[model samples]
Target: MDLHPGEQILFAGRPSWRSILGFYVLGFLGAIVVGAIVKAVDKTGSGVLAFLVIFALVLLVGFLKRIGTTYTITSERLHIRRGLLSRSVQQTKLERVQNVNTDQSLLERILQIGTVDFDTAGTDDSDFTFSGVANPDEVVAAVDRAQRLDPPAAS
Candidate 1:
């Protein structure tokens, strides 16, 4: 993330590892099933290899998704950045932030990870979100602090 000359980062983070727990669980189970099928068919014990390859691919995808995305809160803006090689950035001024909402399923609540959605004034884009963040309440607090501490400069 690049900061402006006087900008200060209030908070910066990536999605939590726990957020990909479901993917890992499903991937492991799928690998086991595929491995068993391959072993039963070939009788060469290649099922182990199949399982390892499938599980490795799943892990790689999950790792990339988690690592490639970033959420940042600064004294003057809120930013969401995605992708590793090719990048996309979305930001809104602190003064434009109208609402900050959080969503957590029962499992997510137990895991202490959730999604934070933002509503910015005059923006029709509803896809602005910080997904799978740990301690979403802290993110909200950071936004509030940023807005409070450094009020937007007059136009």
Candidate 2:
């Protein structure tokens, strides 16, 4: 990530590994089932190869999705960058932040992962969020500190 002159990064991270545990688990189970069916039908050792390939593809997809997205909080703004080849960036100044919210599902709570949402003023993009982040409270604190360190300019 390139920072502007004098821009100080407060928090920067990608989705936690634990956040994608469900994907891994599901893929593993599915691979096992498929492998068993193939082995039963073919009576050959190729089932093992099929299982490995399926599991590997799942892992690769999950890894790419997780690493392709990034959340960044700087003294001046909050930014989210997504996609690898075709990049999309969303950012808003600290002064424009209208609300900060944390959302967690039951599974996410168990895994200790959550999404930190930022509602910014005067923007069409209302879905800005740090999804699947670990330790959401820390992210919130970082945002608070950034805002405090560089308070909104006086009118």
Candidate 3:
């Protein structure tokens, strides 16, 4: 659907299975560390196994939560909705956008997914990123169009 005059979608994406697998691998490593610590303290294999299983479950839940979040861009503002338990909604007005950056890592390039980073004029850091977007170029074009259509107010 076309964005409304005052509405923009910052990002719409489905996290690749590859990305989810990567998280799982990281979780495995974390599980190993926890297992080692538990084994050192208790000298029991059950503790290690239990910790590993719990770690895997936690990572799976986290991956699911990440998949649920939506980051959007509207004509007037940027919006981020994240988390299942304690949801977070952060909005940044279009007028505050100072810079836009696009980046693709090796895996992202291979998978044709890129991230768009937005730098707000008064923010401490550029933490707003549109992750795993399929067509970053199109998004950039849209952002440019929005900026042109809505010029910032004079200081």
Q: Model 2: residues >4 Å from true position, as ranges?
A: 151-155
Give candidate 3 misplaced runs (Cα > 4 Å): 1-18, 27-59, 150-155
lDDT of 1 by residue, 72-103 (tens): 99998899989998999999888899999999
lDDT per residue for candidate 3 within 1-155, as digits (tens), equals 34545455544444444545567777777787788877888875766686768687968776776677776665667776777778876678778988888898888778777878888988885578777667677667767776777543455
State how far residue 98 of model 3 sits from its true place (Å). 1.9
Candidate 3: clashing pairs of residues: 8-73, 8-74, 9-73, 10-72, 10-73
By the lDDT metric, which is better: model 1 or model 2? 1
Tell me model 1's lDDT, rounded to 2 decimals.
0.93
